[model samples]
Target: MATSISFVGLSCFLLSLCLVCSLKEGYAFEELIESYAESYLTHTFEVSSLFASSICNHSTKANERESTFRVVDKYGPCFQPSLHRSVVPPSLTDIIRSDRARIYSIQARLSKNSGRRDLIVEPNSLGIPIIDGSAFDTLSYLVKVGLGTPKKDLSLILDTGSRLTWTQCEPCRSCYKQSEPLYDRDDSNSYVTIPRNDPVCEYVRRPVDPPRPINLCSYEISYGDGSVSVGFFSKETLTMSAAEKINSFLFGCGTDNKGPFNLVAGILGLNQEDASIVFQTAQKYNKIFSYCLPSSTSSTGHLTFGSQTPAPAGIKYTKLVAEKSPFYGLDLIGIGLGGTKLNIPESIFTTPGTIIDSGAVFSYLPPVAYMTFRDKFRVAMSAYPLIPGPTAAIETCYDFSKSTSVTVPEISFFFKDGTIVGIPGKYSFIEYNTTLTCLGFQDGGDKHSIIGNKVQRTMEVVYDVPGQRVGFAPNGCS
Candidate 1:
């Protein structure tokens, strides 16, 4: 059995590492951190405390700054900013630039080190035309916004650039038909638009390049990623369900120079802590929204507008760590695998970072941790030495079939509040091969490593942006 260790704490989180662990009470520590989840819309709090109170309070609850954000009580809580703050590292400007050069160098190495997997690979997403720098499905399933009576059932991207939520007018835009069309505001009969240039608009606005010279109450936005989104500011009704709905949102409808995105029309921002269509609507009717992501590489995912996506009943849920920013992250003080805090050796803990990012497809375990875990895992699995590997299951492949469920180790996360969330079961095995005989999987990368989505899917990631915290457990969120 493994016990918890302490690290650092919040506010004073700038010390190389951002957190520490400190257990409270003498309550048997719950044997394991109890898994649970709670979601409240911004209206749940006051708008005046968007980044301050709502976000701060949430951060205080979960104890990290990775997931909370403040939204004006006057508007709503939609984006978590803590995840998008001023933590500069050699400048992303530089990292983005160096990617192309680095890719050419790592291609051969990556190909030569492939492995095996137990999961099935998706096929529909293969060979899709992606803009440079677009990794994975970053460019998939675009959704366009619209106000009034517009289009319906169209595929669109939920962009962070534009503020308006308008789709193509009747008869559609002369450009290309988006992969998905805009929702007809009039048809659902629940759409409502906010005023032009409201406080919410100012916060969500992403300025566009080659600014369009026009206005019927509008704005423009450009992205650091080189893409652009533009539209007139206005309120729109959202007919989520027969009983749930909201009539307020910022959106645009006009000529976008960023010529039709193939299979994409606009962007549906599922962002909002208290306000956005989903949260606001949820607040008004006491409901929750859910989206589903398919693990298949060949099929498409579904991002539904209303109702919580049905989840496996036994999968435990965890409350997300809220923070004061525009992004979401894990609420982790630290992670100790196999109940061993010092298993990784001081050399790795002192290193810069080991983060959990949903945007990133894999988990990055340090070499020290990987090796330590790999060896112990092997010893535990001494029963099945020549077992089959789960090709895409782990960043590193392994097949020692010691009954994945049987050899489940006590993997734990150190939280700022002295609480540890111990994850049960080895989400995957550690393998040592790159041959086809190894299995159907991705080859591990050189710099440290990534655990990827496969493992991430096993944990319920509570990304409370305004609070700057990330809560992790053995299940995914609703």
Candidate 2:
């Protein structure tokens, strides 16, 4: 059996040896060291600290509606009740493939000639823990919520850009394997299928679709990466926590679901759509929500609904471009490296606009903007030797095995109205191995850019729909 090595507690010599055994099997240690020295020098401290606190244990205790629950990385050491008892942890290839698929889906979805629409709703509050799914083969966040009358726990991907909330349901024609059991409408007294004629079904209705049975409200959502979820558009009681529940919550019970969901039950859409949980209970929560994404996969963060949990003090506000409906849009103007602004033109960002998304793992910039940022970053890292990236999407990689100390330039984002959000070294670069670290930003093509969750880690992100503004606060998650 091949032994897995974690750099956190291992000695440097052991780590160097393990690199050859684990990452480059059959390679001699001396040969590996010679090749490494000729190309790069890396260290273990920063990389080790990244995984230092990632262990998670499941708790049977019920949490208060207003209180937060534990969050874990789906592929980290802490994710409990492994998806498959004997399945080995996903390899790097799997993670890169899944992440690329997700990125393609997002870019393809946004490239379509889609219009933006807004809905009005009221507000209230509730709290739930959010899991980071960046480790292994997934690059999204997960949330644990209850579905139906008796409430069966389901882990769903939390996506701010998605409009419809959904989960795999019973009688699956085609469904991916999930840790939680498929939701059974027969078992839930609160399950209520919406009528085809009901106005609610019109939101997702296709223009070329023929008429269907009045009682059958069907819905289908497809992604660019060929993932699709099709099933009934229904309503049910959504249990937010032990103390809070939302009645007549609109959601999709996916009967034919297939995709790279990473074994999670379904997706919890948090966009501004009428069918979204944000709007469904808008009156109760006031359309205000906030979340703090933990910096490391081993750490925990939260997703809070309403004003019950106050926004962190000294929070900075930025305008949410109202035109970019269904997405929390922001006017990203510039980028700074080592406290020095890049020479890229501001129009490079303003032309296509940008949206902050929780589902995307890495931030993406326009080609010109990304090139400028990458070039500046490379210059700053000139002391370190460049190496091939672990994935196609990530082009800038460094080998740092020889250095005892490293100095990473601070990267910051400049938004409209001069809101400068600093990106911590950990959030800006992902340590793929003790020998390799890559910048987190990617090339988003010429279309609209995206600010993924990696850069948002450890910061409190407040989405105030009614207020038409987004806020950021640093160190909100400890």
Candidate 3:
């Protein structure tokens, strides 16, 4: 269940007390923008550029110069309102394609092989994928899910970008709606609100309004990408796979903001900005988070929590880079294709900043690598008849009839500490004959490659923000 999108809580403090700042003046605008960006990507580390584009290009709030500290305190997130808009998104065709190389990697990690979740991928009554029916083009990895008073039941997106625990709410101003209304807490027995005396609130930055006892209140949170997630706080009893109840767990009931998504019940923020229940609860028991992404071609992958699993010895372990902590677009780094060394030139690495985005359907690359491969593909397609765009040049299914291989070059990244982050040969290439169009970032190279959920599913990747490190090893996910 979710609260209204319009019902986002702000710490009455920053909004009312602080003087106004403007984006035009440069510094103040840059400060919040930078802070929010870190806040945006802080949770899951998986982000879509569409959010950045929306925030910078389409926002009316971008130019404002001054405001009352009360405004910030009251509003909480100043830029969030303008961010609720349309978000250009990536195609699932590419999403499925990203998984090709990962299958091999997973076999080496978990040791045990398995299938996917029971959730089927078939088209809904509307002829689109069931998951895509929610209609949001933008994805933010919940920046944070909040624990609030007036607890309620909620459904949320388990995301990589945001780390706040939140939920949809009751007793809020205005709100958003979907084909259906927000979640009805009345129907669920699982909601609770952590009281003021609870130790959990100590970790939370309180709202400006002191009386707000970490109540279940959906507040507005905006991402640098110009997308928003509206949710409220509540206490919940989370059950592990084995039915072990993790009591007094605070979480959010996510409500949909704008962008590709029409409206959603709630989102689960896994990023670092605010730290979600997943993080909070994980730490409560001295646990860690890990994931096993599966290729769309095959239906399998697992997102693990606690001490469920760990990477094998000898696999690469790179501490997450924390200095630039805010750009939390997945736990991504540079990869070397075809055995390219870590010290290779920057040109091949694409850029120092890469997005380890789990929500993204595909592993997106900048113009050079994409077009270089596209041209080669085009030359080869000449042998067969091809179509483009609206119509598929070839079927969107894998061409199992023939053997094909895509050998992407290998790459590595240099940490600020002068160490190296490496992605082995298994991650560099992928081949599929069936689908012709999945994802294309255009000739304009994006700042970095979006190492999507597809690649993440292949390994047991641990995102340790406090330690500033990301560890990965092959798994049996695929």
Among the numbered candidates, top lDDT falls to 2
RMSD of 3: 25.4
Using lDDT, rank the candidates from best to worst. Answer: 2, 3, 1
lDDT of 3 by residue, 246-361 (tens): 56666644444443333334555555543464466555534355554432221223445554332444455564645333324333333332223223245544343554645543
Tens digits of per-residue lDDT, candidate 2, 1-478, equal 1233544436677877777576566557667777755443222244456443536533222132263434455555545545354324443344445545565555544554443322111110001111343334454566778899888888777778677888999977789888768899999999998877889987664323322443678887765444667788999988876777888988988887766565678777888878888888788988887777766655656777886444477788888998777778899999887666789899999998898888766688999999989998888789889998856776798777776656677777898788877666667776556687778788878877888777887787889988898998877665
Candidate 1 on 93-209: residue-level lDDT in tens? 222232222222222222324222111111111012235544222312222223343324433443221122434432223434443344444464544444444566453343433
Candidate 3 — worst ten consecutive residues by lDDT sum? 67-76
For model 3, the stretches where C-alpha displacement exceeds 4 angstroms are: 1-155, 167-183, 187-190, 194-218, 223-231, 254-264, 285-287, 307-310, 327-335, 341-344, 347-352, 364-449
**Alpha-carbon runs more than 4 Å astray in model 1:** 1-151, 154-177, 182-197, 206-213, 217-225, 252-266, 270-324, 338-342, 345-358, 365-395, 398-411, 422-453, 458-478
Quantify how close model 2 is to the true structure by its C-alpha RMSD in Å. Answer: 14.9
TM-score top scorer: 2
Candidates 1 and 3, the one with greater lDDT: 3
Give the better candidate number (1 or 2) by lDDT.
2
